[model samples]
Target: MDNIYIYMLIALAFLAVADLVVGVSNDAVNFLNSAIGSKAISFKTIMIVASLGVALGALSSSGMMEVARKGIFNPGEFMFDEIMIIFTAVMITDILLLDFFNTLGLPTSTTVSIVFELLGASVCIAILKISADDSQSLLHLGEYINNSKALEIILGILLSVVIAFSIGAIIQFFARLLLSFNFQNKPSWYGAIFSGIAVSSILYFILVKGVKNATFMPDTLKDLVSSSPFQVIGVSFLLFTVISYLIIKFTKNNIYTIIIIIGTFALAVAFAGNDLVNFIGVPIAAFNSYEAWSASGVLPSNYAMVALNQPVGTKPILLLIAGLIMVLTLWFSSKAKAVVKTSVDLSRQDNVKERFEPNFLSRSIVRLSMTASEKFNSLLTPGSKRFIDKQFAKPVQALKTKSEDMPAFDLVRAAVNLMVASILISLATSMKLPLSTTYVTFMVAMGTSLADRAWGSESAVYRVAGVLNVIGGWFFTALSAFVAAAIMAIVLYYGRVYALTGLLILAIVLLIKNYLSHKKQSREQKEADSLERSESSSTQGVIIESAKNISNVVKRGNKIYSSAINGLATQDLKALKKNKKNITKLSNEIDDLRDNIFYFIKNLEEPSLAASNFYINILSFLQDMAQSLDYISSVSYKHIHNNHKKLKFTQIKELQEIDAVMETLFGDIKSAFASNSFTEIGTILAEKKSIINLVTEKIQKQVERTRSEESSPKNTTLYFSMLLETKDLLNATMNLLEEYHSAHDEKVAPARLPGSADPSLEEE
Candidate 1:
């Protein structure tokens, strides 16, 4: 039993490190999103600045360690053994929960998870204690819990969401109104004043609020800040204002960019300073309890954890090591980039791909907002309206830039996002509230985006939906954390060494599973034969791009069509289901190409304007082909999934025959497009009639079977459907081939290749 505790301690130390990795992966979005979104500075510089902040912030996080010990529960009420169980449960739960969120690329609150885990685990252990004592009832559970502090932390986290958003929106609205989109051309004083306010706020929080909690700081310095915070603020403001003015006048750099850089550093510090307890605090507390027990030479269960109730400083070496792990994770974690991308995509200024779909709630919110805006505008005079409109107008050059090259938003909005998040997080940290940096940073970014009018009518509902989904995930985090930690506590308390071993194994397995799953998903995305949007401005350029896409489509389409036929032949539901997924991916790729038609048309050169027509026709045919495949996959999977009667042998044979012929034809089509052999397409087009005849013959034979030998209506209906859709598929494929061949002939003479330069073909 004595040896078991040592192993538990070792396990805890490992869990602490794992928790830090996953926790940082999720929370990196809190500090990284604003700088990464603005694109004001090179990525290397922003990361170096953020890395420094995280390092210092982790060092200053010692005072917060007490929260994990006695903030949620009355540690003195539990024995050393029970306390160990609770700590183990919390660490286990935290690692799994945070990693789950990181894997999904959603930002969730580590503060909420750690806080609720402590509460849940303690409550579970307390309940067992109460049950063991006949004198104590369930109501006496309050004696073991710190209800007030727990409630305060919970409410503070929930309230930060609303407060952060409101403040962010109000500040960003005014900032945009003051600076406008073309703030670069503003007077030097205007830029200096803005820079002054932003820099002063960041510095005040970083020095006064952040350093106040550092374990290494001298008592006199803490006392000085405790006495004259306002004095410190005034001096900082005056000094930075002069500095800002000098920088703006002497150099041509943008002040908002400087603010963004400072804000990134500030938020990183705030996150590490405040949220570090959520990762390592439990293990440190458990280690202290063990030391207190070992020193007393008392039995583990009989030795009460009175030592944990008192505040103890963490070793600076441990903090440094933890900080080192965080910085490494910040730099190298792919999941961190994913979580940051989610935040940036939601707040991008221009229309781009939306990861979330608009739901009814999002749609209603957008509608009500539009109606309110109209009502408010009715009260403004024409001049006032025109002035406001001009101030909100985006620059034409920005609109014309490719979305990949354009920043997610301008530096002013980015500055507001950072400054607002920094203030809220700093305030919460100074008060030792364990405020959720994830909530503060994410909502602030969203609010700033709304104020900056990044959520236009076209994207407003989708963006709103993404926001609502994230908020919903936050609430889910709290609920799940509480339930899961409580369950783990009970298991650990009863099973002891056995339960700990099982859970450690389970956590390891789950972490490995998530890792492999994410890697597989990323690999598929990178290597998948997905269609690409055309970025060309010439007919020849369009042809080259479209040829690659057409080849990809036909290649994937062949596999999907053959899978549906084979699945129907064998009645393999699992194969059919996977085949449906593949086809859907193909369909979605085609849909994405269709969505890019606007940009494709806009990018075309004037002389090659005719290529737009040719490109549109190709997409239409491709879409038709995809739809045919989608229908085939859907019905095939549905028939098998619903346990419908399998087709007879003769029916299966006929379908397989059709599949063989179509496979040959699609192979030739893919080869033609892949090799850019437009002339070979003429042969495929000539053979298209034979393919259609084969499908027609299949349908005629299926009808005769239905009239005479067919017993199942489901089979007959399915057979007829497959034959007809296959006919449509063949026609769409041939139409695409003919369209390409005709366009090739018109552009290049019969004596030359498709892209050969011909004097007669040049419009000029």
Candidate 2:
């Protein structure tokens, strides 16, 4: 009996570890995405922080454990075996459910699953207790049903969603306002001080209050610490404050990216520490009870341990170890992210930066809001589009960029989450209600994601509605778990002959199904790879043939460069415009050709077509540079329109230099095309370095002189316009040049066209 008990305890320990790993891995997606999506911190940093959080959450989770132990059905009413059956059913079901969701990358609530599973198991146990020797039952089933913690859990979930949504919106609104002001006036010390105070207060309350029971400190240590809780808190607060201040001061000149990273990590740690037990608490509780009964040589009871007297034993230590395991899991997750990057369709992510064009609803709202403002302004004069643009549109544009639009709401939501979680957890502790942190926090994030319109217009409202429906579905989860556990218990009790054997068979079947599914997926993937390769090879051949045609066009164009340069330098607007038109036509042809190449590359079936596509992209970029040169030449002609012969000596010098550079680039392009050799392109590209530097310096001087002279409005506008055109032209040229140089360095060989020699075959 002693040995059996010892083995059960060991098994329970292992189960606890398994729960920790699964729970943390699933929950990780909740907070991890925000940090990664924002590019605010590295995966390694988040993992470390999350690990610490899990450790702390597990260690301090005694308060929640007590709630779980006593708030469900009366465990004393059932015999020892019944209790063991219910617990075992709940644990197995909960683990299977959560791990399944995690594998699908769906963010389900572990807390909801566990609570429901326990409810199901407990309900089954209750029904059996009522039916078996009712006269000796500790409590009636009616009384248990009416007074279970299910109601409280339901209410908590509902209230958390509402409160979290409201607070997240309000906080984000104000935070955006502050951010806008800061952008206009640089981040002031006052703003930093206020933000720090607010963040610190929220962090302390949530981490300290929410995690009170989950701490690693033993009773003795806790008693010692609590005797002077205020003093301890005060000293810790002071120490952190000093450190934070120094960090802020040191990073004042740099962006506060490091601080944000550190804060995010700390938050992740806290989340792990507080949430891990939600996943594994029941299994640990059941295992411990099973061990105690097996040791006492008595039939196991269905009765749950009393709330206050529940044994924590080494569970907190086990939880801390679980946290460490999560860090390693996070490392694996990062590697997986990198491996999938190329294949993953990032269209949704790209949509994040798409311009916010107003739909009918938004346009109506904007029109309505501006009505009053427009009427007031109209009293002075009739409103023009310029008025609307200046007062509202421009400011909004600037604010949108500074705030990063709705994504800025993520930080606000996180902050409010900590505050709300602390208060709710504290209330639950005081009132002895069983609330789930996982359900509350995740629902809150979901709500904020909706409110901020992060899901974009098409899906935002529907997703929000779906999330609410899911919350309702959580009740079903609890009901199902309770029912499943009860049924399993009944079968185990009355149909004992094949109970264990049936369960083993069921497990084996599930394992086999999973294995077959994986194999099928692998085979499909391989087939897809083979098809892709065949398609890519054909596409590569077409792109290489297209490149040869483009190269010939480029070589022909180079012959006309000297004549174009003379027209560009002579301030002959008519002649320059004609030359520009010819260049533009060539550029358009090249662009069309490049687009065809890209389209072909994309449709290629081969897996290695990505490399081929890269080479084509480089060629396309070079074409863009030729077009930009034409635009610059056009701008130069326009600038000297009125005073052709009186063109500024400085302007003339700049044009001559630009002309010389273009001539040299054209020669290089011609040489590369003729010899099918791109090796010297990189050095030729680097030759632009001095010219770019000179142009930038000249523009700066011109801008400064104009500002100092208090030039006329027309002069100022003209000066700035010309300067901007120069910059744009320079950038476009450099972009193409860089692409060419990079492609040359990569040494990607284009596939042989029809009637062409294979470059590889001809080598050496």
Candidate 3:
């Protein structure tokens, strides 16, 4: 009997672990995007910060446990087993549902999922309990419905969207205003420090304190650390202040960025700790009850079992175990993301030639949600759209633009957001409505996005309006959870329900799929590496020969330079035009080349300076080719207009021929990019450079000849026009080319690739 109880405890512990892991993995995405998009930190650093946040959040979660215990359903209405089953159902459903959304990169509310799942399970259990025991028949369904916490949760969920969106926009607005004032000069360290402290302090106070059951400081910790709220705040503020100061002085990092990252992590962790109980508390409670009963040697009586409160000492232990499990789950979740990326790439393969498609389930859901939103909109007041357009739509659109680049918070916007959030949350708490923080935050982001005109053009206003239209779909999360829980409860009551059996089946399926995917990826990567090595080896000799030829050409060009220059010039122009169409086609090619180069270089058994040098030379050659293209475009326009006064038709023909050579040079450059042939790129670029210099010299000579002749007004006007066009084209070309080059560089650079072997790639 003792051993059985102990085993049950262990099982409960493991379940807690599973709950924590799933909780963190699912919630991590909510804050992940903001940090990454803001360039606040590297993805790896963000994850690490999030992990620590989860740990601290978990440790301080006891206060929220009270809400988990009594906030949802009346415990007296159902027996111990029934309550346990409801909790288990909620946990399993919530985990799966949240993870599915995370995998899709869509941020949904965990609070909404829990509330709905709990409602569903509780409703089912109540119905079953009532039916089995006839004495409870007088307790009407209306009574149960009225007494239910569903209303509060629903209201909370809905109102949170308005609150968060408004706040985010307002805050971002003021932030931008303050930032703009220092346009010519960057903010000083003192400014950053002050701003960081102010924002962090405000966030900690409002979000941490105002959220009723937020777990940043558990009751136990408050008691242990200090007796008064003021004391606790003072201590925490001082500690954080010192830490921020040290980080700023030593690391020379942006304090605002750091504060945001930290704040995000803190929010994430608090979310996990508080919400974990919503997901798994009932299950743990039931398990504990079962263990208590088994220990007392009780057999079958009613389905109702003994109720057990979690031992105070055991709560911390349970939380720690859960936190660790959550970290592991987060790791698995990352692996899943990689798989999704690969799958996307595979679907886009040239051989497959299929239009990439989302799964049927996703498409169906989106369509249904859209239809529902349209119907709901039509039923509203005739002036509702106009009201939304004027009050929410216009301001939100304007605010969106101002919010870009992590704009400082505006007091007006913040006040508006706060008022909306406070009023909505207060109303929901009073009426017992369920609302979503994700919905609130996301909509506020959109509203601000709209208010600021972040989308750049008014055309996007409708699209954003359409996106805001979808916030209505979040209600479906609660609805679905409710339905799923009801169905699950029916199965538990009537069918042969084996909780462990269901869990084991799911675990097995996920494990097998994960293993197979990993194996396949490894095999594909090896094959790719092999192909790259073979290609590199074959191209090495050709590259060396071209390099030698270029060297000889350069050396012999001192005497009779025109002939050598013209020959090289002709070849370069012809290549450029042929490859212009193919430049955009090299995205995949560059990605593959980057992967191969990093793999080969990193795995070298001996010092391979030649190989390293070869890669560098190739990069240099590509750069030179880009410069040559710029020079050619500048010189070729004079011929296009026939504006050179002293030049003959023969010279014009020669210049046109040079344009042809420039076109050829661009064509080869495009092909090299498309094929991922870094080895050949250098040779092609060298030829391009030789051609550019030849064209430049010819243009310079024409300019001198024209200057020595009469400067006609028509000729001068033509020259100026040509010069303006040349400058415009050069600027446009450089901008486009620079973007392409930067993207390509990131792809090829070993350090830039996510999860690559190179340590530099590992750094942000």
Better of 1 and 2 by lDDT: 1
Point to the candidate with the largest TM-score: 1
In candidate 2, what are the lDDT values of residues 158-230, reduced to their tens digit? 7766665566545544444444323324444533543454445444544444454543446764564446545
Q: Estimate the TM-score of every prediction.
A: 0.96, 0.56, 0.52
In terms of lDDT, the best-performing candidate is 1
Of candidates 2 and 1, the better by TM-score: 1
State in Å the error of residue 36, model 3: 1.2
Misplaced by over 4 Å in model 1 are 215-221, 431-434, 607-609, 750-764
After TM-score superposition, the amount by which residue 505's alpha carbon in candidate 2 deviates from its true location, in angstroms, is 4.4
Clashing pairs in 1: none
Tens-digit lDDT string for candidate 3 (560-666)? 12222232234344443323322222223333333345434543334555555455444334333333333433343333334344434445455456545544544
Off by over 4 Å in 3: 1-16, 133-139, 142-148, 181-203, 206-253, 295-314, 335-437, 458-473, 497-764
Better of 1 and 3 by TM-score: 1
In model 3, state the lDDT of residue 83: 57
lDDT of each: 0.86, 0.51, 0.47
